[model samples]
Target chain A: MIAVAQPTTAWYLILAALLFSIGTVGVMVRRNPLVMFMCIELMLNAVNLSFVALARDLGDIKGQTTVFFVMVVAAAEVVVGLGIIVAILRRRPNATADDMAELKG
Target chain B: MELFVFVLASAMILGGAVGVIVRNHPVHSALSLVLTLFGVAVMFVSLEAHFLAAVQVIVYAGAIVVLFLFVIMLLGVDQSENLMVEPIPVQRPLALIVGVGLAGVLVTAIVQARSAVQTGTGAGLDNATQTGDHDSNVRQIARSLFSDYVFAFELVSVLLVVAVVGTVLLSRRPARLPDDIGATR
Candidate 1:
């Protein structure tokens, strides 16, 4: 890997794909809701990386603009999700996702 | 130079992502998330999306991860979770298969479309020219955000406010407000 070649868009895209896959696996394998949320964040970041890469590749600003919106949405998501988790855990300490099957309060 | 930075940042990203999943303690996972966020920010810099990179660090690493840590402490669920227990015997294996299949499909699609992509198509992205426009990237993003996506930008503000209010409601204890109102009545 000592070559003086610059990494291409393909390289970045491949990396993003791998990252997204890892996140998916984490979401499925982890029972802890908080950790699962973090994995979702990982997947979001993966998509953001690809968006920026493609923006650079196509010389378009739209990709960056979309990423801006994504970041906002992600923040909102994490807040609301953690809030629900807190509420659930407050009622039943050490509650995992499997324990919260019923939506009733 | 660019190659070196790309390689290093990729390493940071993948390593942190793995750490987030494998770590037993929630706090450790949160810290690992921070590492991945920083790496993504670095990648944004390399891609010349400087403003997004800054926002990424501030919002994701600074605020979001802090919120995660705070929740961890508040809930005291920071204790190590048992990773060995398999509630569903075949779930992990199935998840691994799904992840690998998804990656394969994505990579194949990207490689297949690699040649069809037309580069430098959209009024080339603004970069700092030899002339004094060092903030070209920021300026272009602002122009786009305020002009074309302004409505969507405003909607985001609404979404954020709703999120804040909803979270407050969700986390709030189910006080006997209704009964209190009835009593007062």
Candidate 2:
């Protein structure tokens, strides 16, 4: 039977890195806080992907286990983050990250 | 088959990420984020992490994205934003440069470590390393989580409780000023 080579672990790692970089750029350049939060989610997912890939490659359950903890942390972060964003919006309607420069001093 | 699925999932992931950043409306960005989350879930399934894939869809795409949409609607900021405006003079250029540099570094590291990663000593004895007793992935994970990582698991629960309290505290409105004092101001 003819065999096909599966995609390498490096390929998954590279894709995760690319996704992480994109998320980083999005966070850096976006003026909207909500968009920035989405970028953070993208970054978390990227990390989760890499973790799963490594787990599969090494045949370890630890990596898969870590992804669960990471998800929990990400969920907590989103809750706190969106709450802060909502609070900011209440104080100043239509505020962007640029308008949040009151603490610049 | 695996390669095809990876390519499709990665395309959806990256495209959704780009959509999240480039879309003018926050609501559109939220929807794009949903796509990215679903794509990640697909990737999880491809990696044989079925439990994580289920949680990714349920918690991320369901609860988290719904929370985001609720905030977007509550704030009434769904109107399209002016994308041309850049309050920070060099933010976009700097971001692009840094992103490219980071990607290059990561790709280089992965390439250099490819051989070591593939032939490492920790390879599992079987393909289904964690599927003990023919139980599901979720069951095995729960076993390890409660037995070996119980402390960390309990700590996470505590952290979640604290997060809930913090969210409530942060979102509370400030005390209203006296009616008599408000008129003078």
Candidate 3:
């Protein structure tokens, strides 16, 4: 398997999946909005990793294009998302996400 | 050769995942996320997506994490003792059920995705006139963004501006509340 192409993409995909799961757990279990935000970034990166792998595998630039769009979206998302998080922290002084269920009731 | 680097990156990624969840302190969790981003960036490099790798570092590690830490510092007190942020209130059973359900779905999806693998011939990577080899390829990316995706980029700029204004507005305390007699004007 030294000179073989092998199944390298599988490893990347599995890593991405694991990272995605971790991000999900952080989102589900953690209370802090900032931490939640970080988890969201983690999830997005996991997607990005898979996109690159598929891009390389397909030999087309499309997956890279998708990653570029995702990156752009994520950057935009954080700027606005953090701004909202700051706003929330100002009012209730509670940065934990579970207690932020104002819209739930 | 490749296997060694892959192993190193995988270890780092898994360790970072552990730190992000297991750490009690929020600041420590952020540091763990930094580790996670580094691992993802390295993985990006390994994938031969150099540009995406750079973006991962600058955007995630540099910008997003900085904003996260800024929010953490702003919310919590200077000392750790004063930073007793309250825990989230939720039914534990419900949370566990939902989390397990989601994980099951995700694992299934990953396994299905793996079944569709078709290894590349690897030659097409070296030859593409649309995106010329190596250095000039980045320029092609920029050109594509400006020509094809320019409108979306501009929209993002506008969204950021609105966000800035909204954030200022949302955080600002009003001069008076109904119950307050001596609220600052």
Q: Which candidate is the best by DockQ?
A: 1
Name the best candidate (by TM-score).
1
Rank all candidate structures by their TM-score, best first, as comma-separated numbers: 1, 2, 3
lDDT of 3 by residue, A1-105 (tens): 457444467677877877887788777776667777777888888888888887788775657766888887787688777766765565557545656666521
Q: Each candidate: fraction of true contacts kept?
A: 0.87, 0.70, 0.46
- Enumerate the candidates' DockQ scores in order: 0.65, 0.59, 0.46
Q: What C-alpha lDDT, on a 0 to 100 scale, does residue A74 get in candidate 2?
A: 93
Better of 1 and 2 by DockQ: 1
Cα lDDT listed for each candidate: 0.91, 0.85, 0.71
Better of 1 and 2 by TM-score: 1
> Model 1, residue B76: displacement in angstroms?
0.8
Between candidates 2 and 3, the TM-score winner: 2
Clashing residue pairs found in predicted model 3? A31-A97
- Candidate achieving higher DockQ, 1 or 3: 1
| Candidate 1 chain B weakest lDDT stretch, 10 residues | B176-185
Of 2 and 3, the candidate ranking higher by DockQ: 2
* Residue-by-residue lDDT tens digits, candidate 1, B1-185: 88889999999999999999999999999999999999999999999898999999999999999999999999888889988888999999999999999999999998998888888887668877633688988999999999999999999999999999999888877656543222111
